[model samples]
Target chain A: MRTKYLVGFLVIMAAIAYLAWGGLGKSLVYYVLPSEYADNPQKYQGKRVRLGGLVKEGSVQFNPKTLQLKFIITDGVVEIPVEHEGTPPELFKDNQGVVVEGKFAGKVFHGDNLLIKHSESYKPPQQGAKLKPEEVRKLLEEAK
Target chain B: MGNSKRKLTDSLSSFLLLVGFLVFLIGQYLAFKAPPDVQQGYLVRILYVHVGAAWTAYLAFIVAAVYAILYLWKQNPSYDRLSAASAEIGLLFMALTLFGGMMWARPTWGVYWTWEPKLTTSAILTAFYVGYFLLRQAIEDPEFRAKAAAAAAILGVVNIPINYMSVYWWRSIHQTATFDIVNRKLHMDPSMVLPMLIDLAAINILFVAFLRMKGAIAARAAAREEIYD
Candidate 1:
């Protein structure tokens, strides 16, 4: 009887230890919107974070040699430049909505990611100069 | 089956229980003191615990389904109880997953929760298990409850993979796996990998220990019912 009670106590202790450890960690989570980013720019400066918005057409610039790609991410209210290396996702294109994460420096993001959102027959279908479904499929298949 | 050996079983479980607690402490510290992330600085540390909990929860759900299947095959109450125990831990782990995910999201995604399919599926998975418990509560017959619970576990497996692959298939609010701990080319520094491994080990142990205790409690209760009936 005594042993059973003792074991239960130990289990409870372990659970507590886990929670306490998490609490003492380096930082906590912060939730907000894009407009918030513009409000207190300095508070979030130099920290790694993700920004979400639509890809701005004509804003993308690529230095093919160095693979230093640059583009603008916009929530309509704010537009921020993003730089990334390697290959962007197949669906990543102009006017496409995306979420990017990395660090912000010199008024631009050295982006480590580009997560594209494929809207399901939602709305904006780019007019003219954009790849249609067949061309898009062919492009992706060739890249692979 | 015999009371004479009850003391021994209880005592042995106590020893495993102690070891588990020690591992939990060391793991938590490792997670806390782990080095600043290469890019994210300190915010990346949240991944260690959050990922650990999420992983364990997924494992618990799978194990619960396995046990449920076994119960249905052999008509064993012990199997049902084991499934119940695993489901309970799975629920706890799923909660941890959501909390860790939300915390990570705020800094990274600029949103706490999204209507993304992955988050939605995860909510559904947790609800399924919570519903299992509710279903059990309404039934008085142990045999009937076991059958119903087993069926629920089997059906719930469909939601697990859906939660996992939701990001790939849908415009999910969740992010993809960032760094692979085992990728030789993209090796994480010791400060990062060490704590992650330690936490993983600790959580795995915790899962087992939880199962043992809950399983025993359920077993004893059923045994008592047998005597009364």
Candidate 2:
């Protein structure tokens, strides 16, 4: 009975280990960096994939009337133009780390989802930093 | 077991439950009263429950692993009961952690589920404990069942460290730990610290209370089974 149980336990553990290893292997590259995607554009072209990088400074363009937001995602070495629909998350800002989920269309990556990659730090608003009246109204409207 | 001892444990369990519930209420009030985050704003409030539940789940699994070791070392049936009870509670809190995380993720991450390292490892952790119970149910002989479960419980704990470290080890979308236990540093604002600490304490107290209640019930069930035999 002891030997039988030992063998059974080993078999189960092996199976679980295999399953876990497979899961880790597949998702190890959760989002492809801009440089990696730039290395082989054909590999990700037309394929739905997540592209992660910092938003390029002074590159954000949002049209409230069209609900279209455009930005350039950069890894400092390479840059990819991203066009996302819908309002950006509250944390979204210039030079913010973002992960855009979509496919490449020509040189532009059309993103259906935009996610803000926030830092581990959580803080209240700074003493000197203040939101403009319109900005506060916009934020309140978005919160609703 | 002495009848007086049993009565004492029952009263202790009741007292802990009452205290745990009261602390939980206070913790919720503090969580709402805490200031909003500069980035996430009101959404950051979700972390009070999400992180607390996740921490408690990890605690439960580790406690289960320790009890499993005791059962194996001394061949104690009571230890086995306690180990199983702890794992059951761990599973419950793990569900809460996963569900609460999704609720937090939808508005923040733009997706309810993603195949990131932290999430994948957590899913694996949940699966192992679930299999632990399934294995327990499969065995017919009580002694053999205890022996096998003890082995599995010891092995299952390997996932806890892996799950906890997944964010730091991998390039995942999930944020790193706000309360870095290893570095002994907190990354939260001053206003939020008290509420977070209160939530953590409340959940931990509730976990201990639940463990005692569950263990006592398990002991009673074992006693009844033996009486029938």
Candidate 3:
């Protein structure tokens, strides 16, 4: 009976190893965005993936040699340089929100397909919008 | 039911589990490294392990549900053991599912956790099974344990369909099933799927093998205690 346990434990340990190691190669998800891809291009080049973030105001650059590209993607915190080889979306411009698909090749987005996303539009208060100062004044008068 | 029968079950489970784990390792080696995908590169390789674990876990849950029903109907302790074993294993792989998911999510979705249907429903199922285990822990009576677990098993099984339909039923962060686990996609590339299927089958057999081993042990312990009394 203990043999069953010994065997089961060994087997499960092996299975756990297999489960974690069974992939053809390492497939850890990237916690960092384009900037990381740039900082460590060697680590991320030629990987298949989908990356999401906003487009930088003016960082899209296309290279002729490898159909390569350079752009900046920001998560509102950090901006990452992106590179791709394919044609970009119509709205894919600096400062536009975007998600890029493709692999990284040394500090470039190597984007194969560009998916353009627009920020949600909110209407500003009407031009004639008024604020009642009476409530504020009453509170002030009470304080006095 | 007999001692010898129980012993046979134990031997079989251990042996099978060993074999299953080894095969899974082989599948991973073949699918992951040497021949990187020419198109999408290493990222495409994630499909192999991710899909394998997902399918294997699903199979375990279905098996647990079936065994749960059988145990309830027949009042068989063996059935209860099988149901319990399957649930335990199912919970483990379900965890793997969540881990693998986050690994993929950061790269694909650009976020670690999302309230997506597949992720959310999977999380809920994980919680449900945890509750099942907790329920078992609180109850000392085998009959009551089996009854409560069975009821929970049936009710909890609904989450599987909910998980599958999440992308369709609601806008979710998860992608739709482009390549079903069984059906091989041409673009998916044979180099990848080959090891995946093997790993999946290996895991399946291993799960059953484990179910039998642990189940038999529990069954025997309960029986021996009753005999002593």
Candidate 4:
């Protein structure tokens, strides 16, 4: 009985090892900075990849009716145009750090997922620094 | 003396349960009173329960795995009971984690479910433990059942590390861990951290109470079965 159990355990462990190895190989997508991706765009083209960078200022275009989003993600040195089919997340906007998952194509990344990466640190705005009217309105709405 | 000792433990367990419930109420109040996140808004409230449940689930499984190893080494029935009790509680909290995460995701991520590595590994962990319970039920002989459950628990522990590291190992949509233990700092504001920590404490207390109760009942059931045999 002990030998039987030992063999069973060995078989199960082997199966698990095989599955984990294969799964990791298939699912492991390296997170690349925009500059890194630009350096080797052809190498990553048509392969699933995650691109992390800041949304370039004045590069956000969204159409609510069509639910289309287009933005340029930049790492201060290189910018990549990203076209996504869904509405951008509520927090997604110019200058926000974001990580998008998709495949790179010719001069555009067709992203399927957009995740806004917020800063881990939270500091209140400097005292006496006036809040923009829109910012105040947004805060009031959130309070409601 | 034994009767009085049992009574004392019973009262102690009940007291713990009451305190846990009260603390949970306080946690709820703090959760609501805390300032909303700048981005997530009121949705941030879910983090209290979600993170608490996830942490408890991880704790439960680790405890179960340790008890399983002890049972296998010493062949102690008490260790088997402890393992099963912990696994059951772990399963309950894992379910909470999944549902709470889904609810949080819908509004925040625009989807209820995605094939992200963290989400996928969590689902796998839940399914593995569910299989553990089912495997335990399928066996007829108590010794064989305990042995099989122990083996399963030991094997299933592998998923815990995989689930924990999935966010780092793979490019996942889910955010990374909230507490950076290495840095010894939290990733959120102190105001938000306080309520989450309180909730975690309350849940942990509740876990101990539930484990004690469940372990006692399992011991009784095993005893009765032996008498019938």
TM-scores of all candidate predictions against the true structure = 0.60, 0.88, 0.59, 0.82
**Which candidate achieves the best lDDT against the true structure?**
2
Q: What TM value does model 1 have?
A: 0.60
The interface RMSD values of the models, given in order, are 15.5, 4.4, 16.1, 5.9
lDDT of 4 by residue, A34-90 (tens): 899878778998888878889999998877779799999999999899999886777
Interface RMSD of 2: 4.4
Minimum summed lDDT over a 10-residue window in model 2 chain B is located at: B1-10
CA displacement after TM-score superposition, residue B51 of candidate 3 (Å) = 1.3
What would the per-residue lDDT of candidate 3 be over residues B1-229, giving only the tens digit for each residue? 4455434465667789889989988887876553544322355456666777777777788888999999889998888888888888888888888898777655544556744446656666676677667667666667877897888777768767766665556534465654543244333444555776787788787887878877877777787889898
lDDT of 4 by residue, B21-56 (tens): 989999999999987777767878888899899999
On residues B14-118, what C-alpha lDDT tens digit does candidate 1 reach at each position? 766788778878887877776555334576777778767877998999999999999999998999999999999999989988988888766645457654566
DockQ of each: 0.03, 0.43, 0.02, 0.21
Candidate 4 chain B weakest lDDT stretch, 10 residues: B1-10
In candidate 4, the second chain superimposes onto the true chain B with a TM-score of 0.94
Which candidate number has the best TM-score? Answer: 2
> What would the DockQ be for model 2?
0.43
Chain B TM-score, one value per candidate, order as shown? 0.87, 0.95, 0.86, 0.94
Worst 10 residues of 3 chain A by lDDT: A23-32
